[model samples]
Target: MTVVTQEAGAPFGAAPPSGDAAIRTRGLTKRFRGGQVAVDTLDLSVPRGSVFGFLGPNGSGKTTTIRMLLGLVTPTAGDYSVLGLPQARALPKVGAVVEGPAFYPYLSGSANLARFDAADPTAPRGTAARRVADALDRVGLSAAAGKRYRNYSLGMRQRLAIAAALLGPRELLVLDEPTNGLDPQGTREVRALVKEIAAEGTTVFVSSHLLAEVEQMCTHAAIMRTGRLVAQGTIASLSAGLAARIRVETPDAAGAARVLAGLGLPDVRAGEREVTAELGGHAPEEVNAALVGEGVAVRGLAVVRPSLEDVFVGLTGEGFDVDG
Candidate 1:
């Protein structure tokens, strides 16, 4: 890990609007004892009003980077800024829930938020309360606001934690595995809320291992492997460079095989009811042309696009079905 001087002073009174990039970091890294590198040299840019997803396998250092961003753990190297101010300089403007968003189980959701509001000297009580209500409504938890956190379900508690993060009306919200314990419906709710928040001009930084979820929600994403970033971009841009495969089915398997062979493509594998082939710049037209070329009857043709899960495994050299 490389050493650098920490930025001096905090931006407490009012944060300067430093343009639209909500989060930016250069060569951010962290190392613990025994030569363990939790976060390798990392650079990330999260634009304002974008819901950015940081995705990776378990132990990929998403938590470590978030902790560093929050000033809970100092980076061994590099510098970062949040909401247009240097991270070390804008500690007051960053709101985050790292790891499971722990809260005192004894406190009610409203009470917990009230305590946090009181603790923030910069946040007025009325403003905080209004923000809290907005947040709870955003996460679809206004009905559960008065329930004790201990009595709340895991999903409810997670929503409450998100509501807490919004209490100060933070410009940037960083969440680490926010949907870890959520059910399918709860996950959908949180995902929708995240998009809504970003739509309202707040920058959202979410870290999750769920590739499908991220693909559905985030406008831009970065993939990490072994604490190092391996891929970063809009999903469409990243996927555009990947090879396209076709999953074709036909009424006549033998006829399909013959047609595919006639196409003269190098890679072609025939299976029961389907044939997979490398589509080199060939659109659905080529598939039809091939079938017509061979007089084969084609029943169905489905283009196979690489999912984020496929891309993740391809980049990391790791399988996706890990127990963790």
Candidate 2:
């Protein structure tokens, strides 16, 4: 339930994360040519050792913000830090899979990974093969390590891209639409891999439009709409922020409505077989107590909590695509 606090300076000017933040941004904004604002005054805080979901519809500025975080693009204003360091300085500890992997069609998966590892000037000498093998195994791609990149299925290629990021140890992994173009089985596999990766104590920041997938996989979620953050918090807390509602099915619907109205509950509606009302800081027991006290027969009573989807819709005033 922690709300992100944006800060341009490290606390006490120590040049570290304010607390346990893995990624922190303050007023981060990006405007493309023609004065189109892609991201607007974004402030984000991603805690270390957490799987954070960056959620939004298409072209909601998720990719642009991520690009700024990865040092791939310059922000029009504001600043961000990664792993307690400036992004450019801390990038060595960050691994990212953005857009998708670009590999030579003729090369084997292992060879492709080797080339990626070799490109890192800080990598150790003569460890490329072992690193490549371990990375392949980590992503469940050992069987496809020797296969040509062109022959690999879309799912296998995606896994290989992740393997490229894992050539060495990393403190943060940023994945943008990692499940895009994946089949059901592939989606399941990648979701499992994401969980496994976070279980190892690495912080994962995944940008996805798949709200259901994010709901299931993330420890925390931040939602955006049209280049602005609408809500950000733990999933449970986000859901909890919405008002709880109650629906009572009874033959004495009118009587129940009258009782509920007398009890100071707002918006009590009487239907054919139901009297529904916003819980409005009242408990189900209180409603039942008052209704039963008035000789109303409560045939059935249910409480409907607002779901993450409901919260998102309430925040953004639109439904979700559920596919990223």
Best by lDDT: 2
The all-Cα superposition gives candidate 1 an RMSD in Å to the true structure of 7.0
Tens-digit per-residue lDDT, 1-324, candidate 2: 222232434221123345788998888899998999999888787888889899877888999999999898899998888898865568868888898877989999999998888877677758888999999998889998999999998888888888888888888999989988788988898899889989999999998878889999998888887787766767887777666778999998899999989988777889999998878889899999999999999999999887777766666654432210
In order, candidate lDDTs are: 0.75, 0.82
Residue 77 deviation, candidate 2, in Å? Answer: 1.1
lDDT of 1 at 156: 86
lDDT of 2 at 185: 86
For TM-score, the strongest prediction is 2
Which 10 residues in a row give candidate 1 its minimum summed lDDT? 4-13
Q: Candidate 2: RMSD over Cα atoms? A: 5.0
